[model samples]
Target: MDTPTEVLHRVFGYDSFRAGQQEIIEHVVAGGDALVLMPTGGGKSLCYQIPALVRPGVGVVVSPLIALMQDQVDALTALGVRAGFLNSTQDFAERQQVESAFLAGELDLLYLAPERLRVEATVRLLAKGEISVFAIDEAHCVSQWGHDFRPDYLALSELRELWPEVPRIALTATATPATHAEISSRLGLDGARHFVASFDRPNIQYRIAPKSEPKRQLLEFLRTEHQGDAGIVYCMSRASVEKIAAFLVDNGVDAVPYHAGLDSRTRAAHQAQFLREEGLVVVATIAFGMGIDKPDVRFVAHLDLPKSVEGYYQETGRAGRDGLPATAWMAYGLQDVVQQRKLLTEGDEAHRRRQALHLDAMLALCETVGCRRVMLLDYFGQQGSEPCGNCDTCQAPPESWDGTVPAQKVLSAVLRLKRERRQKFGVGQIVDILLGKQTAKVLQHGHESLTVFGVGTELGNAEWHGVVRQLLAQGLLAVEADYGALVLTDASGDVLRGQRQVPLRRDAPRPLRAKTAAAAKSRPAAELPQEAAPVFERLRAWRAATAKEQGVPAYVIFHDSTLREIATLAPSTLEELATVNGVGENKLAKYGEQVLEALTA
Candidate 1:
C-alpha cells in the first residue's frame, strides 16, 4: 500500500504537507475520528483525500453544495484520482453509474450531499460498498449558531451510529470556539482528535471606510486598485444587488447579479459564468458564496455591514485562495448599524439576545481603534497575535477622543424629544437639531426650540455623523425597529448622568483620492518575470481552451500558480516538468508536451 506522503506526491503533486496536515492524515488513516478547523485556503481537503488514498476502500464525503461537490470531483479527476458525486443535478442514469462504480470499488472518493443521507437507497448503497473514510466538509453547518447552518447536517451524527468503526473527519473554514464545541457535540464527535489551524490569512488586506456615496465609492475602489479583477461584491438586499450590478456595468465593469430572489436556473448560470470566466465581478447578497471554490477572487467588497464577524471573515477569506495578495474592503455607516439592529429585534427573546451578541461583536470590530486582525483573531478564541500590518487600522490608525460632551448632546436631544415633546426622531432630525438647522421638518416640528438645538455647532456635519455612528455602535444609542428613530438605551442614561465617559473613534477624513496600500501595489500571484510573462500567457491560453473543451473551470485543469512556476522553470521534458509543485504525474503525462510547446512558442 502507498504511504500518505507517496499518495500526496504521486496523486496531488505536493512534496510535503502544510501545517497540522501530516498528523491529522496519519491519525485518520489509522482509523481515528477528527474535527479540523482550518482557514479557507489552508488545504483542509488533503487531510481527508490523502488518507482516503492510503486506506483500502472508497472514501465517502458529505458536502453541502452541489457546485462544491462537482468542483471537488472534477479537480480530483484531473489529478487522476477516481472521484464521483451523486446529487440532484445528476439524472438517474448518471447516479446509477456512479453508484455502480462505488459498489465495484473503482472509485477512490464519492461525494454526497448531506440531504442524500436521508434516503434509504443511499444508506443501502453505502452499506453495500467497501468504505474507507467518511469525510464531512463544512462541518460548521451542523452548529445551530453558525452563520451557514443547515438543518440536514443535524442528521450527520447518525453516520457514527450506522458505522461505528469507520473513521470520520469533519472540517470547516470558519468557526468560533463556541460553534466549534457545538459542532463536536451535535456531530457526536466529542472525543474526536481536534486540529485547529491559525485563522489568519495574511494575503488578504482588510480595510473599512465610512460610507458617503457608496456606489461611487465602490466604483472608485474598483477603478483605482482592482480594475478588471475577478471579485464578489456583497450587498445587503436584492435591490441593492441589481442596482450595484447595473451601476458597475454602466461604468464599464464586466459584472453580474446573483440573489435568492432569482430563479435557480439564472443563479446557476451566473455562478457557472463566475467560475468559468476571468475578470468578471458578481454583485450579490450573502446567499451567493458559501462553498465557492474559485481560487483567484482578488477582492470581496461589502457595500453594507455584515451581520457578524464570522460572516465577514468567511466572505473575505474567499479572496486570495491561491496565497496571493487580495483586499477585503467595506463601506460602513450609521444606517447599516440601524438596519442590522432592527433585524435583531425580531424572533423570541433568546434568539434576539443571541443575535444581539453577534451584532455587538461585529460593531466592536468596526468601531475598534486598534488592529483589525488582532480583534478578528481574538474573536475566534485564538490569542497572542500582534497587530498585523495588513489592515486599515494598522496602516493608518484612527484617533480615540473623549466624546462625552458630544454623546451627552445627542442623548439629551433624544431624551428631551421623548420626555418633554413625547416624540422620537431618526438620525437626520437628530443631526439637524444638533447642528441647529432650521429646515422645513425641524421648523414644522418646532425642534428648533429644544435646549440641545445648536449645541453641536463646534463639529461639522460629517464629524457629527461620525459621533452618532459611534454612539450607536457603543449601544448607548438604540434604533427603534419600526421607524429607525434614535432612542436611548440604559447605557445612555449613565453617559447623560455624568456617571460614564464615551471614548469615540475619530475616523480619518476620506481622502480625495484613496492612496493605494503597498500590499495592493504588489504583483498578483500569477505574475512572472518579464521574460516568462509571454510564456505564462501562452500556457494560460492553452489552459483556457482545454478547460473550455472539457466544460470545466480553468483552475480545474491547472492553477495559475502552477502555470507561473512552469513558465519560470521552462522545463523541456515530462520528467523535468513533473518536479513542479502542482504537476502531478497524471498532469505531466497528459499536458507536458503541450506545455513544452507553449514554452517554445
Candidate 2:
C-alpha cells in the first residue's frame, strides 16, 4: 500500500502538507479526534482531505453552508477525486444516486449538513457501518456566544455520543477566547489535540477609512489601487448592496450583487460569473458570502463595517488566497456603530453579549495604528515579527492629534440636549448643536449661550465627527436604545475633563476611484496575462511535479518568490539569472538548470 505522503501527490496535486497540516493529518490518520483553529487561507481543508483519501472507510464532512458544499464538491470532481455532496440543492434522483454510491463504496468522501447528520436515519446508517472520520466544518457556530452562532449547531456534540470511536475533527477560520472554550465543550472533546495554525498572512495589506461617499471611494480604489482584479464588496443592508453594485456598473465596473432577497438561480449565476470572469466585483451583504473559494481575489472592500472582528478577518482573508499580494479595504463610521448596536440590542441577552465583544474587536481593528497584519494576527492567536509594509498605515502612516477638546464638546452636547442616554446623533446635527447653530434644538433648549456650545469650533467638522466615532467605540458615548439619541456614559467624565488623551488616527476615508476606473470594465476580471502569470504558475506546477518525484517540500525545490522572479526574468543561462534577488548562491547552483529548461520548454 502507498503511504499517506504518496497519496498526497497521487490523489491530490499537492506535493506535501503545509507547516502544521501534516501533523494534524497524521493524528487523524492515527484515528484521533482533533479540534483545529486555522486561519483563512491557512490550508485547513487539506488537513482532513488527504487523510480521508488515505485512511479506511468513507469520510463524512458536515458543513453548514450549501453553497460551499457545491463549490467544494465541484473542485474535487474536477480533480478526479471520488467526492460528492448531499444537500437540499440536489434533487431526489440525484440524492438517490449519491446514496447508492456511498453504500457501494464508490465515493471516498461525502459532504453533509448539520441537519442531515442529526437525523435518526443518518445516525443509524453511520452506526451500522464503519466511517473514517466525522469532520465538522465551521465548528465555532456551535458556541452560543460566538459571532457566527447557529441554534442548530448547539446539538453537534451528539456526534461524540453517536460515534465515540469513529474519530472527529472540528475546524473554523476564526475563534476568540470564549468561542474556543465553548467549541471544545460543545464538540464533546474530552481530551483532543488542539492544532492552531498562525493567522498571519503578510501578503495582504490591511486598511480602514471612515465612511464618506463610499461608492466614490470604492470606484477610486477599483480604478487605481486594484484595477482589473477579483474582489468582494460587503454592505450592511440589501439596498446598499444593490445600490453599490448598480453604481459600480453605471460608473464602468461589471459588478453584481448577492443577498438572500435574490432568487437562488440569480445568486448562482452571479457567483458563477465572478468565479469565471476577471475583474468582476461582487457587492454582497454579510449573508451572501460564507465559503466562497475563489483563489486570486486581489482585494476585498467593505462599504460598511462588519458586526465583529471575526467576521472582518474571515471576509478579508478571502483576498490573496493564492499567497499573492492583496488589499483589505473598509469604510467605517459612527453610523455603522449605531446600526450594529441596534442589531445587538434587538436580539436576546446572550446574543447581545457576543455582539458587544464583536463590536469591541471591530473597534480595535479600526483604531489600531501599529502593524495591521500583526494586530489582525494577534486577534487570531498568531504573532508576527514585523509589520507588513503594504498596509495603508504601514505604507502611508496617518498623523493624529490630541482629541481631548473634541471629546469634551461631544460629551457636553449630549448632556445639554436633556436627552435620554441612547439616541443617535448624525454628524450634521451633532456639529450644528456643538457650534450653537440655533437651528431649532438649540433655540428650543436655550443652550446657544452655554459654554459647551461653539467651544468646539477649534476642530473642523470632520475632526469632530471622527472624535464622536472614537468616543463611541471607547464606550464613553452611548445612544439610547429606545429613542436613538446620543448620551454620555459614566466613563465619559474622565475623557471629557482633560483626564485622557484620546488616541485618534487621522480621520481618513478610502480614496476615490480615478476617471480611468471604468476602463477595466471592458476586459475579463479573473484571467491574468498568459505570458508571465502562466509562466509563474508553470514554475509552481513544475515545483509540485518535481517535488513529488523527490520526497521534499516544494520550497526545497524552489520557493514561490524565487519561481515568481524566475518567471519574470526567464533567463536562458545560469550567469544572467545570478542577478535575480531570490536566486541566491545555493538555489542558483541547485535548481537553476532545470528551472531554465522548464521556462524555455
Candidate 3:
C-alpha cells in the first residue's frame, strides 16, 4: 500500500492534506472505522477516498443519488483510476462490467446504492472477493430522524455483519445530536474515529421576507444582486414549480421547472441544461435537486419555507458550493405554514411529529435576530470563532422599535374587521383600511369609518408590511382559514389585548416594487480568482470525464482551481503539476502522464 501522502498525489491530487484529513485517513487505513461530519465543500470525500486507495482491495462507496454517483465516477476516471457503479440507472451491460471489474480486481472504487449492496449477486461477489472498505456518503440518510430518510439505507447495518473486517466511514454535510447518535446506532459505527469539520459557510447571505407579490421581490433580487450566477428556486408543489418557472421566463429570466410530474427524460434534459448553462435559475420542488452535482450555484431562493431546518440547510447549501459569495433568500407567509401543516397531517402519525419538529426549526431560522451565520453554526453544534460578515444583518443592521403600539393597531384592526366583515383581510387591504387609503373598495365597505383605519398611517406601508410579514413568519397569522387572508394568531390575540409586547424589526419599506436598477459600483475591481480564469472551465470538464472513468468525486482528480492552474501553466510534466497548488507528490507519480498528455497535446 502506498503511503497516505503517495495516495494523495497518485490517486487524488493534493499537495498536503487539510487539518485532520491524514489522521482520519490513517485511522481508516489501519482498519479502524470513521464517522465524518463535514459541511458542504469541506473535502469530506477525501477521508474515505484516500483510504480506499491505500487499502488492500476494491473500495465500495454507497451514494444515495444517481447524479452524485455519476459525477463522482466521472471525476475519478478523469484521473485514470478505474472506477464503476451498479445502480438502477445502469444498463445490464454496464452492471455486468462493474461486476467484471470487481472480480478482476481492476476497480479501485465501486459505487452502489444500499439496495444494490443487499442483492444476492452483490453479496456473493463480496463473499468471493477481497473487500477493503465501505464508504457511505450522505450518511445521515441512515438515521430515521434525518430529514431525508430512505428505507434502503436502514439495510446498510447488514454491512457491519457482512464484512466486519472492512473499515466503515459515514459522511454527510449536516447532522445534529439526535441525528449523530442515530447515525452511530444505525450504522453500528459507535466509537469510530469521528472528524467534525467547521460547518460555517461565510459565503452565503441569509434574508427572509413575507410572501406578498413575492414574484416581484424575486425578480428584483435576480436583477439587482445576482444577475449571472446559477441559482435554484424551490417551491412546495410541482404546480407551483411550473407557475414560477413560467413567471420567471415571462420576466426575461432563463428558467426551467423540474419535478416528479414531468417525464423522466424531460427532467433529465432540464437538469443537464442547467448544469451546462450559466445564469440559469431552476424552479423545482423537493422532488428535485437531491444528489445534484452542479457546483457554483450562486443562490437558493425559497418561494416557500422548506419542510425542516435540515432540509432547508441542505437545499440552501447547494449555493456557493465553490465558496464564492451566494445568498439564501426566503419569501414565506402564513399560507405556507398552513399548507405544510396540512400536508404533514395527511401523513402517518410518526411522520406528522417529524414534520412538526422540522417546521419548528424552520420557523426559528426565519425569525432569528442574532448573526445568522452564528445561529446556523450553532445549529450543527459548531462554535464559529467569528461572525460571518456577509449576511444581511451583518451588511445593514436592522432597525428595531418598541412596535408595541403599531402591533396593537394592526391586531386590533384584525379583531374588529373579523367581528364586522366576518372576513379576513389581506395585509394590503387591511393596511389600506388602517392607513385610510381612499379606494372604491374602501368606500363600498366604508372601512375608513373605523377607528383603526387611520391609526397605522403614521407607519409607512413598508414598515407595516414588515410587521405583518414578521407576524406571519412567527406563526401569529393563519392564512388557510382566512382563505389567503391574514388574521391574528392566538399570540396575536393576546398581544392585541395588551397581554404581550411584540419586538419587531419595525422599519421596512411600505411596499416593494420593481426596484430601479441602481448600481453602487465597487470602488476597485476585484482581482481574478486565485486559480487561472477562463481556461479553468475546460480543466473541470476534463477532470469530470476522468473522475467518471474512476468513479470518484471530481475533486479527487483535481479541484477546479487546481485544474485552472494546469490550464494556465499548461503543466507538461510531473514537476510542473507538483508546483500547482494542492498538487502533491502522490498525485504527480500516478497521473502525471495523463495530465501532461492532455495539456501538452
Candidate 4:
C-alpha cells in the first residue's frame, strides 16, 4: 500500500503539503469525517485525493457540474490514475464499462453528480462495493443561504445514514461563518473536524472604479493591463455578454460568448475553445465559471456588480490559480445597488433579509475606504491585518472627506417627502429634488416647496449618487422593497441631528489616459524571456497538439507555469526535470522523454 506522502509526491508531484492539507488527509485516512474550507488555489484537492489513494478501496467523489467531472477525470488519467465519470454525457455502454470497472476494483476514483446518488440502482451498486471514502466538492452548495445552492446536494445528507462507517469530506472555496455552520448541519457532518484556511487571495489585485461607460472602462482595463492574456469578462445579462463579446472581437480580441441561453452544442464548443486555446477571452454570465479548471486565467473583470460577496470572491478566485499575479477589476455604480435591492425585495420573505444582508456586505466591500482585501476577508469571518499592497486602495488610497452635510441633505429630503407628501420616491426622484431639477415628477409631487430642495445643487449628480450609496452601505438608509423607494433608517436620525459624522470616499477626477497608462505600468508583462521565448512557444505548441489529440483541455496536460519552468530550466534528463513543481512521478514517467526533447529543440 502506498503512503499518503508517497502518493502526494509520486502521483500529484508536490514536494510538501500545503497548510491544513496533511492534517485533513490524516484525519480522513484514519476513517474520520472532515469539513475543509480553503481558498480556490490553496490545493484543496490534495486533502481528499491523498486520502482516497492511501485508503483501502475506491473513492467516490460527488461533483456538481458535468464539465467539472470530465476535467477531473482527464487530469487524474493524465497522472496515470485509473479514473472514470458517469454523467448524462455518457451512453449506456460507457456507463456500463465504468460500472464494471468499479465492481471489479479496477478504478481508483469515480466521479458522480449529486443527483445520481438518489437513484436506487446507483446507491445499491455503491453499497455492493468496498468504498474508501466519499468526497463532496463545492459543499457550500448544500447551504440554502449559500450563493450557489444546488437542490440536489440537499439529498446528500442521506449518505451518512446509508454508509455510516465510510468517512466523508466536504470541501468548498467560499463559505461564511453562517454558511459553515449550515453546511455542517445539513450534510450531517456537524461533528466532523473543521479545517478553515485563510480566504485571502493576495495574488489578485482588487480594483473597483465607478461605472462610467462601463464597456469603455472594461476595454481600457483589458487593453492596458491584460493585453494578450486569457481572462473572463462577466456581464449581468446574456444580451450584454453577446454585445461585449462581439465588441471585443471587433476590437481585435479573440473572444466568445457563453451563457445558459445558448444551446448546449454552442456553449460546449465555445467552452472548449476557451479551455483549449491561449489568449482567448470568455464573455459570460453568472451561469458560467463554476469549477472551471483553467489554472492560468490572468484576470477576472466584472462589467456589473455581482449579487453578493461570496459570488464575487468565487468568481475572482478563478484567476491566478498558478500562484502568479492576477487582477480582479470591477466597474459598479448606484444602479447596481438598486437593482440588487429590487431582487432581494422580490425574493421570499424567509430569505429576503438574509439576501439583503449579503448585498449590504457586498456594498460595504465596494464602498470601503480601507483595504479591499481586508474587508473581503473580514466578510468570511477571517481577521486580516496589514493592507495588502496589491489592491487598488492600497496602491492609491482614496481621499476621505467629511460627508456630514451631504448625509443631512439626503436624509432631510427623505424625511420631508415622507412627512409632508406622504409618498416615497426612488433614487431618481430624490436626485432630481436634490438638484432642484423641476422635472415632470418633481412638479407632480410638489417637491419644489420642500426645505431640502436644491440644498445639494453644489454637488454634481455623480457625487450625490456616491453619497446615497455610501449612506445605504453605512446602514443609515434602507430601500423599500415594493416601490424601490429610499427611506431613512433609525440610524439616519443621528447623522441628521449632528450627533454623528459620516466620512465618505471622495471621488477624485482622474484622466482616463493617465490612469490606464499607470495601471499598465503596474501590471507585469505576461511574456517569456527573449532567449526562452522559442522554447516556450514550442512547448505550448506541443501541449496544444497533445491536448487536441487526447480531446482534453491543454491545461490538463501541463499548466503554463510548468511549461515556462521547463523552458527556463532546460532540463536535460528526466531526473532533473522531476524536480519541477508540477512534475509528479506519473507525469515524469509519462512525458519525461518528450519534455527533455522539447527543451533540447
Q: For all the candidates, what are their Cα RMSDs to the real structure?
A: 1.8, 7.4, 4.8, 2.6
Alpha-carbon deviation at 148 in model 3, angstroms: 1.5
TM-score of each: 0.97, 0.84, 0.83, 0.94
Candidate 2 stretches with Cα past 4 Å from truth are: 383-385, 419-427, 438-441, 496-501, 508-601
Candidates 1 and 2 compared by lDDT, better number = 1
What does candidate 1 score on TM?
A: 0.97
Can you give the lDDT of residue 485 in candidate 3? 68
- Model 1 ranges with Cα > 4 A deviation: 510-522, 525-527
Query: Number of backbone collisions per candidate, in order?
Result: 0, 18, 26, 0
lDDT of 3 by residue, 6-111 (tens): 8676555556887778888889999998999887767777888788888889889998877557666776666666788888988889888888889999988989
- The local distance difference test score of model 1 is 0.90
For candidate 4, write residues 1-601 as lDDT tens digits.
8888888888877788888888899999999999999999899888888887889888999998886677788899999888998888889999999999999998889899898998889998998888999999999999977999989999999989999999999999999999999999999988999999999888888889888898888887888777778899999999999999999999988899999999999998898888888779999998888888788788999988897899999999999998888889899888787777667766678888888788888988888778999888888998846789777777677888999998999999999889998988888888889999999889887888898888888899988998888887778888887788999888999998899999998754552232354444333323567677678888988888888998988888888788888888888888889988788988898788888877777
lDDT scores in order: 0.90, 0.75, 0.75, 0.87
RMSD of 4: 2.6
Residue 303, candidate 3: Cα error in Å is 2.7
Model 2, 272: alpha-carbon shift in Å? 2.3
From the highest lDDT down, the ranking of the candidates is: 1, 4, 3, 2
Residue 117 error, candidate 3, Å: 3.6
> Which residue segments of model 3 deviate by more than 4 Å?
209-220, 223-225, 247-254, 276-280, 331-350, 413-455, 460-462, 479-497, 507-526, 529-559, 567-574, 582-601
| Candidate 1 lDDT trough over 10 residues, lowest sum | 517-526
